[model samples]
Target: MRQSLLALLAKEPAHGYELKQALEAIFGSAYPSPNIGQIYVTLGRLEKDGHVRSVGVEQSNRPNKKVYYITAAGLETLQAWAEEPTEGPRVRDEFFMKLVLAPMTGLSDRMALINRQRRHYLSLMRELGELAERTDPGDRVALLLIEGAMLHLQADLDWLERCQEELP
Candidate 1:
């Protein structure tokens, strides 16, 4: 959230509401929108950290608004963040932890665990598929995000099947 706001401020100075609107416009409804309070809190933190500077903008009939602009340090941070590669997928995840620990914990029902996770993944895939169908064809970004989720779910289901085979 901090870096996103910094990037937006780098483009131009904006108040918290404007930044929030920009984020929603970019991500669409695919992501849960950040609350106004969250944006303000982030801005406050950024100001304290010297990543952003805020100035009071007075209006005749409305309350004074604090407009934020990104600093040079913020731009450097944003640039570094843009260049950094994201971490790869985790090999030892929550599901794997449960699968390995179940026997020692005396549950000893790996198949049940795998089946339950598989069902959950399939349900998510179905929901995402429906969303994809409802999404406008011209909105390529949303479509791509939905398709990517579906693909990940499919991979998860396949991994569950492998777990079932190997554990049994």
Candidate 2:
């Protein structure tokens, strides 16, 4: 959620509700989106630390909201976070968990599962490539991240193929 907040705040100042909507848009329908309460909590934390500020009021017929603008300090912190190296992306793969139990099931089942993952990864690579093509050339960081994703997926696919070939 921190990542989502950081990315949205980087673009422009937004109210908590606006940030929630933007996050849903980027994530699409695959996962459950963050709640408005969560968004407000994050904004509160940022504000308390002086990383964000309540810039102005956004009046509406329905509900009036306070919009937040990221401070210069916030930008610096975000930039530093973006540039920092991590121990790879933090994610949980159900497929990897399934693979760990594959030997107990059967070699054929394991091979089939690996092939399915390979196909899925290949499809993801194609989608990422298409997205890259549509993105502006000036977005070097985005481009580099996309390329890195493709390479990572390719490596996984290759390993799956090798495993399939070696197994009975």
Candidate 3:
């Protein structure tokens, strides 16, 4: 989020509300929108870390707004972050932990858990499909994001099947 905000500021300075609106426009359907308070908190942290700076702009009828801008150091950080590879899939993730530990911990039947999770993923896939259909055909970025999420969910369902076979 820090890098994302920095990248936005690298384009142009914006007040917290503007930043929140921009992010919500981008990912609100696919992911949760950033809370206004969260945006301000992150901005505070970025300013404290010297990656960004803020200047208060006076308003005639409202409280002054602090607009944020990326510093030179922030631009360098954003550039380096852009070059960094995203982390790949993990081997021992939460579902894996449940598949292995749930029985021992008396949490629930493993098969029941798997069945429930499979249903959840399928439901999400259906929702994403609907989202894709509703999405503007020209918005390739949003379509690609939905497609990627669907693929990941498909992979997760496949992995659940493997767990059922091996653990049974």
Per-residue alpha-carbon lDDT of candidate 1 for residues 1-168, written as tens digits (9 for 90 to 100): 998999899999999999999999988867788899999999999999999999999999999999999998989999999999978666538889999889779876887788788788888888998898898888777888888878777788788888888885
Candidate 1: segments with Cα more than 4 A from true spot: none
For each candidate, the alpha-carbon lDDT, in order, equals 0.88, 0.77, 0.88
Q: What is candidate 3's lDDT per residue for 1-168, written digit by digit as tens? A: 888799889999999999988987776565677888998999999999999999999999999989898999999899999999988967548878888888998879899989999999899999999999999887777788899989888899998899999996
Error of 1 at 62 (Å): 2.4
lDDT of 2 by residue, 1-109 (tens): 7656866887988888889888777655434678889788988988888788886675677656788888888888888888998677543366667776777866637
RMSD of each: 1.5, 5.8, 2.4
Clashes of each: 0, 0, 0
> Candidates 1 and 2: which is better by lDDT?
1
Ranking by TM-score: 1, 3, 2
Question: What C-alpha lDDT, on a 0 to 100 scale, does residue 102 get in candidate 3?
Answer: 89
**Which 10 successive residues of model 2 have the least lDDT summed?**
23-32
